[model samples]
Target: MLDDITGKVMVLENHNGQQLEQQPQQQQALQTPKSGVRRSTRISRPLERYSPSLYYLLLTDSGEPECYEEAVQVETRKKWEQAMKEEMDSLAHNQTWDLVRFPAGKTTLQNKCVYRLKEEYGGRKRYKARLVVKGFAQKKG
Candidate 1:
């Protein structure tokens, strides 16, 4: 069954795969008035919507490989290599970092390439690669 509340349709299914009807309170709210004009539970006002960058925090992709080795094991090694090369080229073009000699008693941060498949709704998939510094390795200043 489909319930329309606040102009949004919500479809709920029971454990037995049967659609569930709306609760009595929801039904009463949807009841029409005796007046000539019908009352609607549907919301006519515009809603406030926002897409935050932290949306990824709520999602976890089990299919995604965690590390470069795992990525190579799952996806085509050639594709990962091409993606890495592209990322490196972009970093170089942007001059993202510079090589420097490590000071004595100071630790140098390690870096790794993170690879993932990015896909848009009804759009083509893309292989993305990014180099991330191991920030935890940095010494407290």
Candidate 2:
């Protein structure tokens, strides 16, 4: 018997000391998609472009060439949730914003630092930024 198990060696019994022969006509056909419509297949590799047109652009600042080579900037992606949570925790621990019901016709009488936090709604967190006033300042105007 022919085995296709990975990383393991098979021990075969050679009774009568005969060699095994494989027949090509006993092969099974691979399964294919239905003939009526074409099923889409996702491409699994990067695209390659060849023989493309090349143009040299000379970037100058008021008749002076900045450099002979072009500048390149590469950016990597990041997860903002962890950083945002840390910032929110620091703001809350420092008592940056006090949750209170301020009476109508009354405004904060102090210089403040704006604090922000994220609130989740409908499977997404909406950020709420608030201006927190200092307690030691008198109202102006």
Candidate 3:
């Protein structure tokens, strides 16, 4: 499916897996505007050039880092570390937790860092690293 200014273009397949093209936009009849309603028309503007890199980036999946050491590049690793530090700073500012002595029989659960590549509404790529508790070990309150 592809979306153009006219409308969405849908491709269909037959029982035998033969591809079929839907009727062209020109053949579709136009509907008359309703009575007592004013329709606003938009001025046509030049189309923007398509970016192949942006298209490929959007289509491909960027996998998360399995471990802290899994970050391949120095810059990527730095970004992860910066994200972690920012999170820690926020947690500290909010007083999310307090440092305390560990109970003798209890074990402290270790946290894991997860990486996600996000695209902003303005088409900017963001590298986000989130720290998550290994919650499988946590019991119901």
Candidate 4:
């Protein structure tokens, strides 16, 4: 039996001349529409009609990796690795940091890799990677 209000399927069984109602194992509760609330059938303008490029942008997914480990695990591992390499090269060229031995009594700050997918004006996607230090861990000078 189909319930009109809840839209749930109810199973009715007769056992020993007694009728029993049994509900399905998996049941989902649906909200019942209020009275005098009719659904609209109006059609609005399509996104492609207004701007095809915007429609394409909306459909495209920016599959950017979250971390360094995830970046190497995805299908575009080479691209992500290249982006990381480029970022490291740029940092080295600009003398961003110096490699030094850790001090015995001081704690070292950790760093994280951030990835972004930038879309150019012509819809070309650019994979960018940035290495940032955790500044919140730093102490006052």
Candidate 5:
């Protein structure tokens, strides 16, 4: 029945007439011609200049508050306050710090609230506020 088959057929056998499994053929690597010339696949085109108005339309400023006083004075003051409250609640829930008295002769570090406008899916904006300590003020012990 095997003799009726056409094309190249690999056959492996042992002394006991048991057929051995054949390994798969390895693929050949693509080789360039002897001239060593490589064909350019990309087409070169003239660069198009864009107008400044297009950039202004695409990249709108976030207009987030830079400081706490500015945050409270902005039109989105309620949103910024809510965000700050949420941040404080999260820090308290995580037990990030404990209330303690200031150490004598030790300078206290200053903290500031940073605000940002986070854009969500479908053009929705979310207010985000983070409390950051001024670590640079700390002196090396």
Candidate 6:
């Protein structure tokens, strides 16, 4: 009954199966061309935009790699420029090095170094670069 479930089974009627052997050349005719397709590969890292200008965050942690491509919006860019200008102007106005040519005054007070930091202005998250003079190097000529 189980054999009859799918189809009728044919019994071997003769032992002539070995007599119907094919020539060795006939096997070669069944070969088909092989495909040249390659397996697909993907990268999981973040994409970077290459531009002439790039910025980075200088972190205090010595061994950390802080490389990233940050995008600044137009409004933020304007604000950053303004802030940078203001900071530079302020530094200039302070005459950080105006009174030079003194006799190399107080070596005791020469340990201080001046550094200008970029502070945000006009409600923008973007920042700009600024220049500062190191107070310790101020010479009294």
Q: Please report the candidate that would top lDDT against the real structure.
A: 4
lDDT string for model 5 (45-102, tens) is 6454476766565544557877898889888899999999999999999999999998
Candidate 3 versus the native: TM-score? 0.49
Model 3's C-alpha root-mean-square deviation from the true structure amounts to 25.7
lDDT of 6 at 128: 40
Total backbone collisions for each predicted model = 0, 0, 0, 0, 0, 5
Ranking of all candidate structures by their lDDT, best first: 4, 5, 1, 3, 2, 6
Q: If scored against the real structure, what TM-score would every candidate get?
A: 0.49, 0.22, 0.49, 0.54, 0.56, 0.24
The per-model lDDT (C-alpha) reads: 0.74, 0.45, 0.73, 0.85, 0.84, 0.44
Model 4 agreement with the true structure over 19-129: per-residue lDDT tens digits: 686655566788797798688889877766679787566545557776888899988899889999999999999999899998899888899999998899999988899
Q: Give lDDT: candidate 2, residue 111.
A: 45
Off by over 4 Å in 2: 1-78, 107-141
TM-score of candidate 5 versus the correct structure, residues matched by position: 0.56
lDDT of 5 at 30: 86
lDDT of 3 by residue, 39-98 (tens): 779886655446677656654445556667765554577767777688778888999899
Candidate 2 global CA lDDT score: 0.45
What lDDT is reached at residue 8 by model 5? 56
| Residue range 1-141, candidate 6, lDDT tens digits | 123477864343337654343333433466687998886687555445432233332233222222211112332445445655776687788876565655663453433222223337775343444444356666686
Error of 6 at 39 (Å): 27
TM-score of decoy 4: 0.54
Show pairs that collide, candidate 3.
none
For model 1, the superposed segments whose C-alpha errors exceed 4 Å read 1-62
Tell me each candidate's RMSD, in Å, in order: 26.0, 23.6, 25.7, 19.8, 15.0, 16.4
With candidate 6 superimposed using the best TM-score fit, by how many Å does residue 2's alpha carbon deviate from the native?
90
The candidate, 2 or 4, that scores higher on lDDT is: 4
